[model samples]
Target: MELTYKNSKTIDSEQLKNLYNDVGWTAYTKDIELLQQALLQSLEVVSAWDDHNLVGLIRIVGDGLTIIYIQDILVLNEYQNKGIASQLIQDVMSRYESVRQKVLLTEEAPDVRHFYEKQGFQSCDKGDLVSFAKLN
Candidate 1:
């Protein structure tokens, strides 16, 4: 597959819905308008496309100078294991290389941990740091 990557906040709504739905991220797909606005407000958004198909995406948010939060990273199920997600992450990282803190919070799963660890993220406790969240 010839994959093309784009760093743009503008994305077709249908493509965004399809991609989020493909990955079963119902929280995003259930409210496409909110998702789109979130992307517009993000510090950066990197998307992977296979021709007309949106296969992967990585969205980041926060002040670009001191800290950046990795808000989302996803690849279609069929497209996983092919490095698309990694490329998306790399695109964001490279763009914000000077940002002092890069942070992300994801579900606690073995594969998830391994993937982020491989990409140079240490678990919060590893650095004697703790994270808190308030999700409704």
Candidate 2:
């Protein structure tokens, strides 16, 4: 299937819900309005689409000049491992290449580490750095 990528913040509620639910991110799907609002306020959102279907997305937030955080990067389960995630990451990296710091906090899994490392991200433990977050 042919895929297209674009820098867009608009997403259909049903499409957003379905994509997040397919990836088991039920918290986001539980409140579509909040999720949509978050997307609207993000610094940038690069999305992948197959025709009208939302297949993957990478959302960024932060001061675009100094730092950028990868707030969310997800691909539909059926769309995983076809280079969609990699491409999404690459797209964001290219867009923020001049930024001094790029960061993301994800579940610590061997596969997850490997994926980000493959994209040139070093683990916090590997460097003189640490990160903390407060989640509800």
Candidate 3:
């Protein structure tokens, strides 16, 4: 399979839908049309395509060259544990090498946390920036 990675500058609406859903984030469904606007300038959307399909993806949202927040790391179930996530994250890291801080948040799952650690990320005091939605 041919592996490919591209940034937000190259992504259109259709590709966004495919890659976002490929990572198990159905919540993005309602936001499909808004993704483009939400991801305005300075965001780098990283995606890995296996020839004919989008298998993995991650988005580095940040103010170019300073600090970056890595988000939406999704690897299709069929492609999980096969190093596609690793490569996708690595590629994103490289693309934002100019940034002094790179961050991401995931529900406190052991396996999920371990995956991030494998990429050299350390757990730290996140401070007062986290909030959750209240389902009515």
| Per-residue alpha-carbon lDDT of candidate 2 for residues 1-136, written as tens digits (9 for 90 to 100) | 8999989898999999999999899999889999999999999999999999999999999999999999999999999999999999998998899999999999999999999999999999888998888999
Q: What is the TM-score of each candidate against the true structure?
A: 0.96, 0.97, 0.77
Model 1 C-alpha lDDT per residue in residues 1-136, reported as the tens digit of each score:
8999998898999999988898888889888999999999998898999988989999989999999999999999999999998888877788889988999999999999999999989999687888988998
- Those runs of model 1 whose alpha carbons end farther than 4 Å from true positions after fitting are none
Model 2 scores a C-alpha lDDT of 0.94
Q: Which candidate do you rate higher for TM-score, 1 or 2?
A: 2
Between prediction 1 and prediction 3, the one with superior lDDT is 1
Off by over 4 Å in 2: none
Against the reference, the lDDT scores of all candidates come to: 0.91, 0.94, 0.73
Task: Give the per-residue lDDT digits (tens) of candidate 3, residues 1-136.
Answer: 5688765445566766766676656677568766666656437766777775767777777786778887578877787898988998888777677778887777788898788889988766445554454554
Better of 2 and 3 by lDDT: 2
What are the per-model C-alpha RMSD values against the true structure?
0.9, 0.7, 3.6
Which number leads on TM-score?
2
lDDT for 34 in candidate 1 is: 90
Ranked candidates (TM-score, high to low): 2, 1, 3
Pairs with backbone N, CA or C atoms under 3 Å apart (clashes), candidate 2? none
